[model samples]
Target: MEKKPNDVPKPNKENTISLEIAKDWTKRWRDMESTYNSHHDCRAFNIPLIDLQEVIKEQGVVSVRGYIGVEETVVEGDTVFIEKLIIVGVDANGKDMISSKDGLILDQESDDIYDFSDPCPNLCDPKSPLNG
Candidate 1:
């Protein structure tokens, strides 16, 4: 799916962005690749997940502290964990490097939903999300 200009993720007040692939899109695109390079169409637009990550990293910073928020789910009363991840970065001296924090912006509006679980299970866990 095409990411709308406003759908871009952003950094928090402390300055940080999240890095995550659209799971469904990634899986589907990767799966199609496994079949017969069906992902060539996606390749045309250069919207691959890796490329997107690079853009995020270049534009903002990755948040070390994962955040959690409520998300609508396919199952009733089954809330999903909106994973807090990062994309932007800071220098060794701890300074904001990215000029545009827009890359770190997230769609946390009421209609914008996400999973509460950490997209990176190894990095950020439930505890962080819960407290976040």
Candidate 2:
């Protein structure tokens, strides 16, 4: 079947059955591996489940704390790092959102000159279109 863009597949009875079978097989494999490793002292390394959970929790806390306000912009030299560029309406809904361009301009005073006297063929001319 041809899938359209943004199409979501609906689950059926066959899919549910296959998913259950896969889960059962995975669990059995894990149990067998654990048993074999326990007696043989296998070199396979695995972090404890509790430790993994704690690490995940710490990561979530750090991510939440790292969030900056929408108006905040951190700049080092000529480089700018905008936290978030969003226009909010009076009702607290987002009107528009913009993202910063990425690239390190090594030399801003380079002698290279781009002639923009004619209208840009890419429709990205910064000058007023009505004037032209």
Residue-wise C-alpha lDDT for candidate 2, range 25-66, written one tens digit per residue: 334445555454344322212233543333224311221111
Residue lDDT tens for model 1, 1-132: 334333243434323223233333223334444543331211111123553344334433433122222222333555332323222334455554433235333344311112222333333333654525
Model 2 pairs in collision: none
Candidate 2 worst ten-residue window by lDDT: 63-72
Off by over 4 Å in 2: 1-17, 37-132
Which residue runs does candidate 1 get wrong by more than 4 Å? 1-77, 98-132
lDDT of candidates 1 onward, in order? 0.32, 0.24
Displacement of residue 49 (Cα, Å) in model 1 is 8.4
Candidate whose TM-score is highest = 1
Clashes of 1: 25
